[model samples]
Target: MIRRWIAVAVALSLVGCGEDPPASPGRFGEVTSAVVLVNPVINQGSTTSVATGGERSGVEFQAEDLTVATDSTGMALVEDLPTGTVTLDFDPGTYSFQVVREKELYDVVLAYRDGTVQPLFPPVRYPLGGEVVEVEPGESIAEAAASDDTIVLLKEGTYPGNLELRAEGVLIFGAWSPTRGPLSVIEGNVTVLGGGNRMRGVKVTGRLTSNANTFSAAFSDIASATITGNGVTLLRNRFTAGQATVPSSNAVLVDNTGIP
Candidate 1:
């Protein structure tokens, strides 16, 4: 009887000594939030320049698989960003941004954020001829005639001649006097320079592009023209015609005067 009791006690002790089940592992914590800021400027006029904010004041933020958030102060807060380097994309405009990690702060000037960095300066001005270059009525000139090297100066007179620019280059139509009228008509790829100029009387039978160089025109008439290529900017330029078409190859740069 005594031996049996001792065996039973030993069995109970062994059962108690068995290892307990392992505790479950804890989960990862949530990621912290980040913020960015953007500011843009819109210019309107010729000799006089002004900076004002309109209904078009807004910045777009792009990240991989993440939607960015912005506040009234132009601060963009990025959520759910993993613990690694992140790339942010923005529109074509000037931006002042700051990156903060813990208590450390980083200041940066971002003109563009994507695959490359573009210059922040506006388009370079190409001077028109001191004397206007007049084209006679019913005259036709080829791209070779209007050499890409020269800036054709249109005089303040009726030019019934047709101008053609076949090669890739800039055609600057500037006036010595601010009061001088704009180009009456263009038949090829050209950049009209000067503000408050009118293109209502002008007719474009070929491709036409503006580098946002700030030229004025009252009426614009385009026919089967593709406004494509780099540095093709248009700033407050009006277009009017009986029939006009914008080709898929054509692109317009707004408020961008960068060199091609």
Candidate 2:
């Protein structure tokens, strides 16, 4: 409900004025705060530049440093912020997200209530080694995949949006290497329409589906999977919330956690 109102107010501000104010999350309170969610489907660990109003008549203002936390939901929160418009400046790079595999980071803002704000950030993946294309911040994942064959070096950054794998035999490997690389979170649901794809070292917070496609994965974290593809092997991956929803298929699952 609070988020809805905030959205409404932002919208009205946008409508009233020709453009957004220089500083946004505009129109936020003395107690105004925010919750940032990384859409794991699109990010490596994300960092935001934060500014807030001062304690006095909303005239004085100060910048606040944000702290990242990895709770059960792995969300971050800011509290006791002054009621003032806030704007986030995103810097693209790798971050030590404290997860097995690095996930991409996406930032979201909401009304700061009595200190209960939650948002999810996300996007990654894999092979021994292959032809590589290193991605940058706010680039197109699908475009990179479509052009680059064999492997994609998804360096620490946020993709513009979700990804759909159209190339067969392409291995989407997140980060620079296994031992190295920051958080790589995908922001949207993913589907591999082609076959013989491989992945590792990426965190996806949305549903994953493979239709009649065969793929292999390891060290990847998936929210959920619906695999109709045969000859699939999932090894040492993390599945949150539930297990893979598969019908009849030759699927191999080994050392996967969080499946009931």
lDDT of 1 at 183: 35
Predicted model with the maximum lDDT: 2
Tens digits of lDDT, candidate 2, 1-260: 00111322433443464642212111121123343422222111112112221111111112255534322332244444333333332222222211121111112422121222222212111212333444555676676667324555454555544678888877665542234322466777888888887665666778878874558665577888886667675644677867667534355444356553
Give lDDT: candidate 1, residue 241: 33
lDDT, candidate 1, 1-260, per-residue tens: 00111211322332364722111110001122333433323222222122223222244657556655444533354555443454565543332222222211121112333324332223222222122122333343232234333323232233333343342333333222212223344544544332222232244545454333223221233443333222333432333332222222223322312112
Regions of model 2 farther than 4 Å from truth: 1-130, 176-182
Error of 1 at 256 (Å): 12
Single out the weakest 10-residue window by summed lDDT for candidate 1.
Answer: 21-30
What's the TM-score of every candidate structure? 0.33, 0.46
- C-alpha local distance difference test of each model: 0.31, 0.45
lDDT of 1 at 141: 28
